[model samples]
Target: MSTKTVLITGTSSGIGLATAVAAAQSGWQVIATMRDTAKAGALLAAAEAAGVTVDVRTLDVTDPASVEACLAGLDRLDALVNNAGAGHLGTLERESVEDVRTVMEVNFFGVLHVTKAAMPLLRASKGRVLTVTSVGGVIGQPFNEAYCAAKFAVEGFMESLAPVAATAGVSVSVVEPGAVASEFVSNVGLADNALEQAGPYAPALSAYLDRTRGAFAHAQTPQDVAAQMVELLAAERPAFRVLTSDAARAFAGAKLKDLDGSAVQTLTGTWVA
Candidate 1:
């Protein structure tokens, strides 16, 4: 049997890097992509350390041309992992419209760009489309309004397309992860100054940050999330949604089980006042 090939975006670090390495070690021909090839040294070193090979390619998911050019070179693609995403942290009042649009561009529209570019190849190969959403996608979190909105949009988009994609022999799945130990915090532009700049929202921002810090204290590792991605890709019939850890499932389950918005409000309200 021939080895399967998988293309994953944002492989410069974190879950994308871990997934790329793990998939290669598991016998898949991995195409690990990132917006900037210069940052690929870490992924390359990790792959070498694991005694596996990954073809690191430059791909900015926010750019349709880049997505097309990157995938155009690939001869085989059995799986498309839309792991590229941006993070945003700030209340709507503090967040600029431009910042919100940036998040939407990368986290929401970026997925569409890559998925649309890969659909033809995926349909021909009977491949899978797996995306890394977040627990915030299931239930909106304080200070993550814009980010969560983008994730929620992606979740809805994928869920709606899953059945239609299935008819073409494509499988669609989403992996929702809670706080995973990664560079995501910094990537999302969250910094110490965020609280200082909250203005009238300072006290609430501080409380929310405290709660967020507590949650990340027991956060899952990138490998933990990557493991779930591997399983989703390998499963004969993967589920539409797979939460990375027990905490993630429990956290997201609150909203999943509660048809009314009360449960989510009660939970998120804890970080406010």
Candidate 2:
């Protein structure tokens, strides 16, 4: 059996790294792209120790030139995982215009740039396109106005792209995960005075922020999310979206209906309960 080729972005840590290993272990050729090759040292070492070859390249998703350059080297591709994303935590008013723009650049526009470039390869191979979205994508969070906005854009974009891809023999799917045990939230963008300068909804937003941070503290591991990604890769007929855990499933159900039952409980239950 021939190994399928996969191009994944943001493989330095978290879901991206875990998914890279999982796909490679499942007999898929993996190309792991990160903003800094040095940051991917662990991934390279692990792939080497496992005797699975992975092509690690530097790719700044925000840069269209960089995205195009990276895609040019790949002779063929079976899957393109738009897993590169950043979180922005702050009330919309507290976050400056530039900070919001930066979040959109990395989280929304970056995904579009890479997906646009990978479309041709995917169409040619009749492959799949997956995005590591968040529960935030479905339901907006309190302090994460900017982050939620960006993910909402991803969800909307993918929903529209799925039908188009279907006609072309290409599949598009999204993985909506609640809180996952990764450095993604800690390392994402934040305003210098986010805490001091709350938006119009300071009191409510702060409480919401507390709940979100706590949920992330006890979130599921990256491996748990990666397992679902592997299943999507193997499915002959995949759905448009897959929630990573029970929390995710519940969140998706509530979010699609705009339910405001209990964000904290829904976000934390998948891992804790």
Candidate 3:
């Protein structure tokens, strides 16, 4: 049988890089893409060490032209992994509306652009679309208003698209990971004096940071999450939603089961309190 082809975005580092390597090692023809090709060194080095091959490409998901150009070169696509996203840490009151829009552009609209472009190829192959969302997508967190909103949007988009996509022989799933040990945290743009600039929200921001630090200190590795992701991609009938860790399951499960929304409100409220 021929090897399946999978295209993954945001492969310069973190989960995208790991998933690219893992998917390739799992016998898939991997197309690993990032906004900047200059940062491909890490992914290249890791792939070499793993004895896996990944086709590195420039695909700025936020740019529709870039998405089109990248997919235009591919003849067949069995899977599309929407892993490209940026993290922002701020409350709406402290941050300008433009900042939130920037986050949405990368995390929300970017997914739509790529998915829409890949739908034709995916439909032809009867393939799947797997998006890497977050536990925040399910449970809102303090000081993560924009980031959480974007993730929540992705979760809803995939959820609503899953049934619709299935009718076209396309599978859709969202992978929710919690506090994975990856560069994703460092990229969140937390200035050195972020708390200092929090003004009246300083104490609350400090508390949220403390809780966040604790959560990440024991975070799961990207490789661990990637292994699970590849398995789902390889499954004959994969689930619509897959949580990458026990912590993620517990964290997202609360919000999933909460009908009144009070439990989630109380729990996430404690993060900032």
Best by lDDT: 3
Across 102-170, the per-residue lDDT of candidate 1 in tens digits comes to 989999999999999999999989999999999888999888889999999999999999999999999
TM-score of 3: 0.99
Best by TM-score: 3
Predictions in order: lDDT:
0.92, 0.85, 0.95
Per residue, candidate 3 scores C-alpha lDDT tens digits across 1-273 of 789999999999999999999999999999999999999999999999999899999999999999999999999999999999998899888889999999999999999999999999999999999999999899888899899999999999999999999999999999999999999899999999998889999999999999999999999999999999999899999999999999899988898899999999999889889
Taking the candidates one at a time, how many backbone clashes does each contain? 0, 0, 0
Better of 1 and 3 by lDDT: 3
Cα RMSD (angstroms) for every candidate in the order listed = 0.9, 3.8, 0.7
Worst 10 residues of 1 by lDDT: 186-195
The digit string of per-residue lDDT tens for model 2 on 32-133 reads 999889897888887787778788998999999999999999889999999998877765555578888998999999999999999999999999999988
Off by over 4 Å in 1: none
Candidate 3, pairs of clashing residues: none
